[model samples]
Target: MDLSDKQQRPVPQGPRIDRTFFRQNKKINKINKLKNKIILVRVLTEILLGALRIVHKRNTRAP
Candidate 1:
């Protein structure tokens, strides 16, 4: 039952793969990172704009 012992059993084989899979995975990871960065920048810009609007309103309303 203890598969931890390498002598007890050989490692199970997994799906066969080629270099293309690795290259595609790397490209996908890079794209994901780019998407996340874009999203973060967009969210930050929106927050800053909202804050600026609030500040402008407060300044205009003050006597």
Candidate 2:
């Protein structure tokens, strides 16, 4: 028997996340956030140190 186009068409399911998979995804997201925070802090600290070095050199030259 030949199936009609409508009958052969597949049903569409929207995105679905199972419980275990969702939990794992949340854990990974948390880890990524922490890694980003650490990188941002390290970059800011380097910039501050560079500014301090510049200020120190100017202060020493002014005397």
All candidates: TM-score: 0.73, 0.66
Model 2, position 15: C-alpha lDDT score: 80
- True lDDT of residue 55, candidate 1: 96
**Model 1 per-residue lDDT tens digits across residues 1-63:** 222432232334567656666676566666666766899999999999999999999999959
- At residue 19, candidate 2 shows an lDDT of 67
Task: Tally clashing residue pairs in candidate 1.
Answer: 0
User: For candidate 2, lDDT tens digit of each residue in 10-49?
Assistant: 3345686466665665566666667668999999999999
Instruction: List pairs with backbone clashes in candidate 1.
Output: none
lDDT of each: 0.68, 0.67
Which prediction has the highest TM-score against the true structure? 1
Of the candidates shown, which would achieve the greatest lDDT relative to the real structure? 1
**What CA RMSD would you report for each candidate?**
11.2, 14.6
